[model samples]
Target: MSQSIFILLILIPLTFTQSVRGKDCVCDLKNSDPAFPEKKLKNVETSALQCTRTITSEKMTDLDRLMLGLQQRVKQVEENVIVLEKEDDRNLYGAVSLRIIELEIAEIQDLLNKLNRTTQNYHHLSVQPAAQLEVMKDKMAELEKFDNMQVIKTNRENERVKRDLEQCKEELNATTAAPPTVLPARCGLGRVVSVAGPRTYSLTVFTSYTYGAWGRDAQPAPGDENKYWLVVLSTSNVYGNFIRQYGTLSTLLLGIGPKDTYISSTNPTTNTIQGPNMVMYGNALYYNCYNTYSVCQFNMTTRAVSTVALPKDTGYSNKFPFAHLAATYAYTDMDFATDESGVYVIYATTSNFGNVIISKVETSNPPVLNQTWSTSLHKRTATNTFMVCGVLYATRYLDQETEEIFYSYDTKTKEERFDLKINIKKMQTNIQFLNYDPRDHLLYVYSDAYILTYELIFQ
Candidate 1:
């Protein structure tokens, strides 16, 4: 009886509260009446706004307005089917949105499950590999121990063996590096005959001026060149060293030096030249007795000189003007042209292309010509440089096309190489003279005071 009374007391209050919810109090009822009080309507308005905020859809604000309007319209009993139709779409959209949320949750749960499974599989792999790794580590340690033992055994003997090998290597090196027992004066290459002078030869200087009675004195002063001596060697080398010593100036070639300038090395009183350009045949010196036109054997090792005929005035005007200790000049023939031996003297001609005619030198014959060669070159001004055979020659031709610094007349091959372009541009002047030495491959070019050397690029 007491338990029944306790149950009745609890049911009586709960049943009374349920009855009050079905009545028209907006806050306490399960649903509100259309004619609810203002205060209750305010509460409903606040709750609706809260619900609107919890919805994430973009149309939630408009949907809340439509829902409010429908409730108000239904309260007024207005004739409107469009508002109901819109309300129906809102309910349908809510259903569709709830389904999308459910799908998203299901997808998230599926990804989480997959991740957990992967983590489990990783743990299982770790458990399976741990023992095998420990076994490998143990084997590796044992192999390392074996290697150490082998190294220790070998190291015990390696030091002594290395020392013995080093000692033997040092002994072998010392024996091989020592000099030989004896050395000879003349080594592997036998008896070298070293000479710096040219082999001796003769020359024929043709002159009409007699020095003893008619012409100028034999020994002339310096800066004077008229009468000169010709020194030719056996190798056909010519040196005019005899010029400054005993030459007569202002008349013929080979001008002599001043009285005190030149002294004879052999005949001091007679004023003979130092012997240069001597020809050595097989190992002996050759000396021709006199400067004559006819070839006559004066010594067993001597070489003779003959007159090559020339065309022009050969006695005075065309002779060598100074003494030189170099190759002797030879005229090719009787005419002012190329001779048989291919020796020639060049002269600039204002009439034709820097005209050049070959004239042979002989003591008896008249000036003759052998061949005529001309190059169309003219110089505008001085200071031009020309290079030939490592020597620089200049141009003195007062014309337009002469800008050469060096020039070469190759007789053996009959070729001429000239620096007409380079010499002109470099010097900014005309070339006057040129000398070339083919053996040394040197070209000495003159540009004002500058001497330039150009190595010939030969084919």
Candidate 2:
């Protein structure tokens, strides 16, 4: 009786121990804890079935190869079906029953049908888990790249803020030590105003042009600094009709009342104001000349013009004037821009080096290049560019209903941010021209036949 009790105790504990070890094995895998001791056991198909979701590039490649092999097999089966269709019971199976031959052919046909169906489904299966994950991985990699760029950009901005704070302190000290003087609005900086206008003013001087510039002239009359001037870049009108009037600098005043007319007295030719891009500063209008690295400055005061030659090896030296719309993507090799910091000519270098180069205008008979900032971002990536507070903002198409502020380069910080991603509600047509006025902090955009204005609130 004691021996029997002893055997029962041993057997019961042994069974219980096996049960506990089995539970431990399940717990280890379910928790995914590698620190747990590995249980030596078999028949774990349930866990294997549950862990079938892993997908990698190598696995996807193997899947693609398998799909290709299956396609080849399908093709082979199709060829066999053709061969079977030609086979005659009398010749191939002389002693075989006709019903047996038909059964064999039907079996082959059924197998071929199944293979074809499987072939059709192969793409759907491959795309769902593997191809979808591949695309997701690519997007994640791009996001990581942007994150690294953001870190660098943030560090640069911090240093710039520090410098600006010190400069502000110095300015405050100087102001405290000196006499105070107040400046009037006329002496202050000029900016674009948010004027809601679907109002169409006829182009009396130059009827139409695909690519041209129009902006508020620099104090046209003594107190009329807000008056705008229209300059046509091409003779080709909106309908593709060539007009001779656009051969000259078609400068017109834009406003109501008496000053709203063409300024024909200072008409210019190809020697000046022929560039596709133009910006007005003070009493002069600057242009990047067509098919040349020359910048023309047309003076509204004296009706005189001066041409400034860019470097001979400038990448955009002999390029044709930019078209408002292109077959594929919009390209702007030279864009004359102005902000509170004054006027600047933005262009790409000869070698390009995958960047746009900005040259500041200095006071000279023919304006001299003061300073240059080479943005590390490519020029072809943007549709239009504008400057505000010495920072260059570039736009990209985001769809018919939206446009995105995709890229920016701060001259002060020397930092480039390629993923600003600020969405601006805009029409989808090509944005031919973009100009920012600093006085009122408004962005003037020209797309198709519409002139749109948006208020830019700076923080």
Candidate 3:
């Protein structure tokens, strides 16, 4: 009976264990059981691990794309840096080349100044320096042939230098010493001793015209003394046919009371004005004729056009004109001026080697050339020329706002003076036209687009 009880206890224990296992199995099968929840959590963990792996792969792909883009950008930046470096090198080379050219020009100019000084000192020496001068000129010619433009520029400079050398040679070879200095014969209003105030300043009626001529009538009629005349070169700042007349100085200053007089009613014809340099005298407007080397006089009362052909080979159409280092006045080859004596035309001729040639014009039926005078002054070197008291005064550019009357040629005695230092203040850089009104002793200047008048001081 004890053995039987032991067997029952063992079996009961085994059956109890089996019952717990059965309950476990049943809980696992039921979805709402806690054991089932644990098993479901394990499956969810496995799924989450798989999803994380997939997301990691996608992040790696995006990282690879970003890395590739960064590499391309770095390459582009390197290329740009290389291009900039090459450009900088080229710029440096160009700057160095320009500097070298400038230095060469300066050296040539210095050599020219030295040559001028040597010629000036030859007066005290007994030996003729002709051979030395020739050698220097040869050197200058070689230097001038650097370029075509340089050749043109240096040719003008060399002309002046050659003239100076010729003068020196003449002085050296003279059998007799230079004559004693004789005081210049004083004519009407003596020499221009000084320049005074810019008494009147008037921007003209046409402000857009940058080049023009303006003044009162040098030889006025009875009732036209107070009338002021202006001619604006409207076409290319070079050609026009209209003359604008203002009644008085007040009217001119106010840009009011204008009367337009057309030389020709049609398009620019032979009688039309050609250049900026023009003047009014005795009810007639004198100007350069269109497309010709002649001076045209348009009579207001008669409405008649009279032209006188200039000397043959007279510089026209910008072959020669008033020039400075900066610019040249185009088509101003013929400049008309009126002095105490009479009317005159100042021009340059190739026959005269581009020297200033003055001719007296008689205001008869057909204005005829009366007397011609040649001066040693080079035409292109002077910026503008005007007559005062029968003396031709030439001005040169001193600065942007100053013009120096550095030269004079008296027609009475044929005397030339180069020591004049009278300076006139300027409103602008360029003076396109200049005229002296003998009636009022005033200088009428057309500069840029302004009409400026200055009172002259006589000694």
Candidate 4:
């Protein structure tokens, strides 16, 4: 009985403990602080991170090489383009000369095409091996670059240039008969008025050289044998000629020529005089020798010679009979003009007041002086100031001074005259410069054998 009671007590306690564990196994281990301890995973994580780093590094290296290759390719392309451009320019050396060569080539090609063969060279028309190769290369290269339309366009441009060259040559050849260096009417020109019309201009130049006389019964025609001729050449649009011959030294218009070379007479043309300052007026070839200043008109339409009055001197003749520029001088050198009034011929004469005298030819009495203005202001050269709305611009020379001064003459309310700050340095012996072209309001100054221009800011 005692053994049975003891077993029952022990067995009952064991059975109760096992039932609690079976009901909640995790809850039953409440006495333990942690269910599972933290683990150590260093090796696997470290290896994966290292692999990622290696992949990034390899990608960076590959990208650098790709960039380098791209830069080299671009540089190579640039160098090749530069070389090609230089070769093109080298091929075009003396490009203007190519025009002439092209003409010869075209003619040769025509002949060769007709005969189905090329020609052999002669002494005058010889071709070297190198020359032939160069021509062939140039022609083939240029032809390859052109389409059919481009070829036609190129041909047209060449033909136009050729035609222009011929016309320019013809005009240039005609000037051998006269001495006035023909300049193209361009931007740098000042207009000197001729009573012939509005578009006429004055030509100013210096020339020298002389002969004793024209006819048989002449005196020892005198002055400086040093040869200087100051002339008043007039420009006229009527005859398409530059000089109308307002006045000249005795020789140029009346010099001895081929048929009458027996010391008979020396005259230029037998023409007629038309209008004032003898602008655009041509003369018939004078049969006999006479004074150059005594002239008349030559008409292109009617083509006749009529007498015009011998102009009263616009003074300035103290040291007159300008010996040097006898047959070749421009009339505008001693004249004044404006768009409002026609023109004024000013001269410092021996008889008249040294004050300015004007020829008002545009009035009722065409030959009379409209008004006599006596502004006794002195000038450097014998040339006078042209007045526009009472403002004056005159060229003058001081006897002892080296430079020619341009005087801007104006008066205050009390008629007090003043000068301005405009001047040009002409200190040298003067080798033919300063021409006036009205087409452009400027002066054509030739200095140091180069053409320099000054524009007239007309006030």
Of the two candidates 1 and 2, the one with more favorable lDDT, higher being better, is: 2
Candidate 2 per-residue lDDT, tens place, 78-167, comes to 543454455453454333334434544554465556556655755555556565455555654444443423665688799999999999
Taking all chains together, the TM-score of candidate 1 against the true structure is 0.22
Off by over 4 Å in 1: 1-305, 313-342, 348-354, 358-371, 377-419, 424-434, 444-454
Error of 4 at 402 (Å): 7.4
The candidate scoring highest on lDDT is 3
Writing each residue's lDDT as its tens digit, candidate 1 over 1-459 gives 346545654433222132234655332222221332456445545655554454444423333333433343243222122223333343644554344335434544554565455556445344444554555456545443434236645875798799999999989988888855432211222211111101101111322211110112112234432332222222222212222223331111212132322112333122121122112112111121223211111111122222232223322222321111232123210111111122234333334432332222222222233445444333222222222221223333323433333443433234555553322223313111122323233233322222233333321
In candidate 4, position 213 carries an lDDT of 9
> What lDDT is obtained when candidate 3 is compared to the true structure?
0.74
Which candidate's TM-score is highest?
3
Candidate 2 RMSD to the correct structure: 26.0
Query: Each prediction's TM-score against the native?
Result: 0.22, 0.49, 0.59, 0.30
Residue-wise C-alpha lDDT for candidate 3, range 111-158, written one tens digit per residue: 456545654554333223344445545655555443333556878899
Deviation of model 3 at 145, angstroms? 83
Better of 2 and 3 by TM-score: 3
Q: Give the Å shift of residue 386 in candidate 1.
A: 9.2
Off by over 4 Å in 2: 1-208, 218-221, 237-269, 317-331
Clashing pairs in 3: none
Work out how many backbone clashes candidate 1 has: 72
